[model samples]
Structure formats: C-alpha cells, structure tokens
Target: MKLRAPISTAVAISFGLLVLLGIFIPDLADFRNRILNWAMLLAALALLLGLFNLAQVHWQRVRGREATVYSAALLVTMAITFAVTLLQGSDSANAEWIFNYVVVPIETSLMAVLAISLTLAAARVFQQRTELMNMVFIVTLLLLLVGAGPLFGVELPYFTRVINPYINNVLALGAMRGLLIGVALGTITTGVRILIGADRPYGA
Candidate 1:
C-alpha cells in the first residue's frame, strides 16, 4: 500500500503529459484517443456506481418506518424508467414519450419554482440589507419577470420588446461568457495541479 502511491502518481503524471503533448503531435493523437476512451469507460462505470449508491440509500429510507413514501416513489420510478429505457432504447417512441411528458414537465415545474424562489429570496435580502447589489438584483429580476410576457393581456412594448431582449441578449450573454471563461480557467488550473502531483483526487 505504501509503495503503490508513488507508482500511481507517476502513472498519472505520465498519462497527463502524454495527453497534453498529443494535442500538437499528430502521431500521439491515436494514443490520446485510446486513453480518452478508457477514461470514458471508467467515467461510465463511476456513474453506474453512483446510481447504485443513490438507489441503495433511497431503498434504505423506503424500508425505514418513518416518512418512506417519497423514497418508495423515487425507487419505483427510477426502476421503471431504467427498465423501460434499457428495453426500448433511448430513441424509441416510448422513451421519447416518457422524456417529453414526464421529464419536460418536471423540469418546467422545477424551473418555475426556482424562479419564484429566487425572486422571494431577492426580496427578502433587499428588505433586510437594502444594499445596492440587492436592490439591483431585485429590480433586474422584476423587470425580467414582467417583461417575459404580456401583463393583464396588455403588451408593454418598451419592456417586452426592448428591455427584455437587451437584458437577455446583452447583459446575460456577457455574464454567461464571463462565467464560462472563469470555469475554463479553473479547469486548466486543476488539470495543471493534477499534472504536477499537487492534487491527487485519484488517491495517488
């Protein structure tokens, strides 16, 4: 066990360097692709393990004497969904129906709830803090919500047609881009750390 750590670390760093070098070297691309495919298989296995762990936890809850309805429902739904998807294939009409009817509605409902929750949270913050950032957040949220559709069946041209598009296309787009840039930088930093053996999430 003690000897294994250095070996693992060395293997990890070697693979990392190879993958990085493969980008500019055409000859190494095939090797890189092979390594990536192996990584992907590992990732899929990890995901399967995660699902099993989740189901086990929920199953435990379902077996317990207290408040088990939600857990039972979740387990049943997951089992049914997994079985159907596996049998029918993801592109099958049954799977498509399940996705469209079940998944879409659930996602839409969750989004609606999230929007309302965010607005309420913003309002609470504004009420308590009365800070400039909080005020801006609430005002921006209100404007976006009001501008989303016609109010009382009356279209507000200034908001719906103008401000809504501007906020969504310009301000929101810029913010999203900035976030993506930050994420990319963070990913690079993490990869570098892993390569240098500064971070060993793989128990190296």
Candidate 2:
C-alpha cells in the first residue's frame, strides 16, 4: 500500500480550506497574508538547499581530480556573486550595476543565440513541408511579428483592424480566463484528494 495517500488527503483539505476562507471570509485576510509570507520563507529555504547541493557537487568534482578547472570556475563565480551582493547590499548602486550590466547582457545574448536555433528550425519545417500548412504558419508568424513591431511607423490599417480585436479580446482574455479556471479546478481536486488521503508530495 502507498504511504502517500493519507498525507495527500490532509494537505488537500488544508489547502482547500485556506482557499475557501481566503475568498469568502474578509476577516481571514490577515491569516491568508501570513500564509503567503510563510510560503516565501519556505521558498528561500529551498533556494538554500539548492545552493548547498551545487557547492557539494563542485567540491567533489574538484577534490576527485576530475573537471577541476570547470568546478573551480563555478565555485569562483558563486563566491564572487554572493560576496558582492552581501558586501555592497542589493539596493546599492554597485550591486544594481553588476546585475544590470553583467547579468542582463549575458541573459540577452544567450536568448539571442537561442533564437537563431528557432529560426533554423522554422526554416527546416518549411523545407520539409512546403504546403498550405507551411504557408499558414509563415503568414501567422509574419502577422504576429508585424503586430508587435514599433507602432510609430507606417500603419497597415487593414491588418491592424482585422487582427487587433481577435488578439486582444479573444486570445488574451481567453488565456487569462482559462488560467484562472485551471487554478480553481486544480485547487478543488487537490483539496478533495487530500481530504481522502490520496495526493501527498511530502513524506508525511
């Protein structure tokens, strides 16, 4: 028999109660706020666990005489980043500059490099299937790109008139409503499962 069943049921019930109370009882607002704060604290603790795991892996690689250089670099980068933030404080000019100048540029460059692979994949798809489907795909992509481009230039009034309403009202609102419904359903299902002792993620 699976030990997870009982734990899952209890967690599901607790989560469900929290959600219902949060929505229906104005007096429970403070309790809900505290729970959110506790969640953030838990997330920070999880991050510490991840940092510890990373350090352990790098230390083993360096000490075992395997991939020492890469391991060393990882350790050095972690140390420097941690020290800079801790010493200068996150709100300080130096820390902000380091984040904006170094991290943002690296992230943007990596994203740009990844975009090239996407472009190549699109080309391959067109080459393999040069049919109506490919034409639809290319046209949809062009419309999306042009719609998102700078609005100050020459206006394609016809394209905008046709696409803008569908995209804004249909696509955006549909996505948001779908997401909310999914969250609500998921919460209810999890609550029911936990109440019945069947959906535990924790060892409890």
For residues 31-131, what per-residue lDDT tens digits would candidate 1 score against the true structure? 99999999999999999999999999988887784559988888888898898899999998888888999999999999999989986887689789987
Considering only N, C-alpha and C atoms within 3 Å, which residue pairs clash in candidate 1? none
Window of ten residues with lowest summed lDDT in model 2: 2-11
Candidate 1 wrong stretches, greater than 4 Å: 1-4, 64-66, 140-180
Q: Model 2 residue 11 lDDT? A: 59
Q: Lowest-lDDT window of 10 residues in candidate 1?
A: 1-10
For each predicted model, how many residue pairs clash, with residues at least 3 apart or on different chains?
A: 0, 5
TM-score of each: 0.78, 0.72
RMSD of each candidate relative to the true structure: 3.3, 3.9
